[model samples]
Structures are given as C-alpha cells and as structure tokens.
Target: MLIDSHTNLHGETYAEDLDAVIERAREANVSGMIAICCRLSDFEEVSAIAERYDNIWCTIGAHPHHAKDRPDITPDELVEIARHPKVIGIGETGLDFHYGYSPREEQFRSLRAHVEAARRIDLPLILHTRDADDEMADFLESEMEQGAFRALLHCYTGGSALAKRAAKLGAYFAASGIITFKKAEDVRQVFRNDIPEDRIIIETDCPYLAPVPHRGRRNEPSYLPDVLTGVCETLGWTPDEGEAKTTEAFFRLFSKAERPS
Candidate 1:
C-alpha cells in the first residue's frame, strides 16, 4: 500500500468535501496519509480528521510561521498533545527564512522545543527547513552534540551540504513535487546519490506541489504516484519498484505507524 507521509488535509481548501478528496486518494491507491498540524488552532482539526479516517494519521507541533506566537509552547505541551493515540510525530517545525513570519530567534527556540519533545517522547519529528539550511544545519549539529533525536526533513529543498549533514545526523529526507519540476534537476541531482535509499521519503506537500501531469493544479494525496514517477525516472527504476521501495523506506522512518488492521 502507498502512503502520503505529509499533507494538510485539514486546511480550508478541503473544508467543503474532505471525504471526497480522501476517497479520490483511495481510488488512486493511496492507502494512508499523515495529516499535519501547522498551528495551535490546527491540532483539533487535524486530530478530528485522523479520528474520522482509519487510514489517516496525524502529527502535532506548530509551523515556523507560528513559532513566535507559540514561544510559550513547551516540550511538555507538545508531548501532551502527542499522547493522543493517533498522533504519530512531533512537527512540521524548523527554520523558514523565506517568510520570516516569526523572528529567526523565535524559530530557533521553537525548533529546539520540537526536538526536545521528540527526544522526550521517543517519537519522530517532521522538519520544515527552507532558505535557512546553513543556520538549521548549525543548530542541528549543535543539538546532536548534546543528544540525538529521530527526525525527518519534510519537503526538503535544501542544498547538498544540508542534505549530507542531515544524513550524517541519521535523519531522513522527504522529497516533494518540486523534484518533478524542470528547473529542480539540480535538487534532484543533489539528493539522488547523497541520501541513503532507506532514509529517503516522498510527500505531496499537497494542496501545494502538485507533480507533473497536474503540475499547475491543486495538489492532493492522490498525486503521490506522480512524484514517485519522477523519483523512479531519476533513479532509473520502475514505478512499481520505486513505490514498494519508498513505501518500505517510509515505514522504516515512521516505525510507529503499524500497518492498519
């Protein structure tokens, strides 16, 4: 079965007919999804969606944009939210210099909180690193010196140095629809050989990075095969083999997600 490891199914874009969207994904062969929480207010909505769909799981933590608002958002609070049976991971958190919606210092503080929470609870972290890869790598290296944590750089768009650094830290890398774009050949080449096969992940980052065939349209979990198609092409493998291998890689990272009964 195929898994869309990252998505924001609770966002307003799906407000009118989330069921239809999910049903479409199922018909497209997507067996599961991890609905992500982007803010304090999104936790309940994310959790509710996870509860409603047996195949969908959820993650807890604030995004970089909301970091300043959640300064008081403690590791204890994150761990508490993660105690929910359906909550399988600890973030969508990390540095985002592109928008700087929250101050950089606060973003660092927030990222540390997520790392601490993941370490404390023995859960995986979902990272979101953008233009601040150098800063992120520096912080992550320092943090790794103190202690280790399980984490994945979700929708990774970082340069080779950052990717190599994360791999050295025993962290996983999640690729999104950007890898399928014409100009992202550089990104594809950077990650193709550097990352270990088992630590690589594929995500739609949906409602956002829709892969080719539907490149300009709104994205959804159903389009994962499109991203996988690109990955297979780059890696010189068949789509079925790539799906099986990446799905295997996904499970290895999120071992907390037992196959649904």
Candidate 2:
C-alpha cells in the first residue's frame, strides 16, 4: 500500500473526473491520500472530498503563496478549524521565496502562525519551502526552540545545508515526483545520504510535478508508484520495503489520520 502525503485533488484540474482519478489511484495501489487545501476558501471543497472517500484525508491552512491574502489568520483560528476529525495536518505552509507571490515578511508571519497552531494541536505541519533555504532553516530552528512540533519538508529540492539543518531539527523530508526528473540526481543523492530512511515519505503534489515516463503530463495519486520507485532506488530498497518504511513514516507524522482497515 502507498499513501500520497500531499495533493490538491480539489483543484479544477481534477474536476472533470475526480471519481475516475481516485479509482485509478486505488487501482495503482495508492491506499490513501491527503488532499491539501492551500486557501481557506477551498477548505470546504477539499474537506468534502475527504469526507466522501474513506481512503482520503485533508489538511487546513494557507500556502505561503497566499500568505499576504490572509495575513490576519490566527493560530487560534487554525486550531479551531483543525478540530474537525478529518483534518489531520496543520499546513501546506512555509516560505516560497522563488515566486515572491507574497512578501517575505507576510510569508514568515504566516509560516510561524501555522507552526504555532500545529504545536498547539499536536498535529504535523506540512511545510513547503523553496529558494529561501537559509531563512527557512533559521525559522524552523527558532520555532523548535520555542516548542517542538512535527513537520515535513514537502517536495524538497533545496540545498544540502538546509536539508542537514532540518534533519538535525527532527524534520521529515518528503520526496516528490521531482525525484524522477532526469536532472534530479542531486536531490536523489540528498535523500539517499542525508535524510534518514525512517524519516522519509513520498508525494505527487499533483497537477504539478509529474515523474518521468509521465513527465509533462498531469500527475495524480496513481502516478505515485513512479515517485516511490525513484525513492526506493535512491535508498537501495525494494518496492515492498520502501512501502513499509514510508507507510510507517506517514502514520508516524500524521498521527491524526486513521489507518485504512
């Protein structure tokens, strides 16, 4: 069994045949998935999908890209909404300096707020970081000093320095379809050497980075095997071994997610 730890299944990209897409995922051996909601407005739709599918779960929080839009969202507000049974994680949140979609200050504020909420609720934080490696590492370090909280650096393609720092801080690193890119050997190396096997997970971040063989095409939960294959190769593990390790890692981090029977 496989679990896609991060995805945006509520996006219009999957509107035409969301049911079919989900069925394909099951057929491909993807046992479960966490549908991420990057905007507060979309949480309803994202949660609805999670409620409709026994194998699906969802998260509540803002992406750093939309940080400026909801600069006033409080940690208390996040904690309140996250009380829902289906809400298993605190964010798809963190800094994304590459796009500069939101001011660095706003992004930092939002990230901290999400971190605080995760700590308060004892749920894992799903972090998204980009070109702001140094800042991100510092922020996480400072936050850890305040109080420990579980977090995953989703789709990590950052520098080794950041990876080292995050690992030291007890953060998990989730590999994405990016690992399967022909030019991603450096990323593969980081996962193989730097990240601990027990602290690693896999994702699709679909409607986005699709692995090779399916590169340039729309990604979905069904394509997770390709990413898993890449991760298994990087870690020198067989498919079954990789699945067991990652599945254990997933349940460990997102403890709120009920294991599929």
Per-model TM against the reference:
0.97, 0.98
Q: How far is candidate 1 from the true structure (C-alpha RMSD, Å)?
A: 1.0
Residue 164 shift from truth in candidate 2, angstroms: 0.9
Residue 220 error, candidate 1, Å: 0.7
**RMSD values, in order shown:** 1.0, 0.7
**Structure candidate 1, residue pairs in collision:** none
Q: Give the Å shift of residue 94 in candidate 2.
A: 0.4
Evaluate all candidate structures by whole-model CA lDDT and list the values in order: 0.88, 0.92
lDDT of 1 at 154: 90
Q: What is the Å distance of residue 74 in model 1 from its true position?
A: 0.6
- The candidate scoring highest on lDDT is 2
State which candidate has the highest TM-score: 2
lDDT of 2 at 232: 88
- Candidate 1 residue-wise lDDT, 1-261, digit = tens: 778999988877999988889999999889988999989778999999999998799999899999988798889999998999998999889899998899998998998999999999988989898799899889889998888898799987788899888889999988889888999988788668777777777899889989988988989998998888888887887878888888888888787888755
Off by over 4 Å in 1: none
Question: Clash pairs of candidate 2?
Answer: none
lDDT of 1: 0.88
Q: Candidate 2 overall Cα lDDT vs. reference?
A: 0.92
Which stretches in model 2 have alpha-carbon errors above 4 Å? none
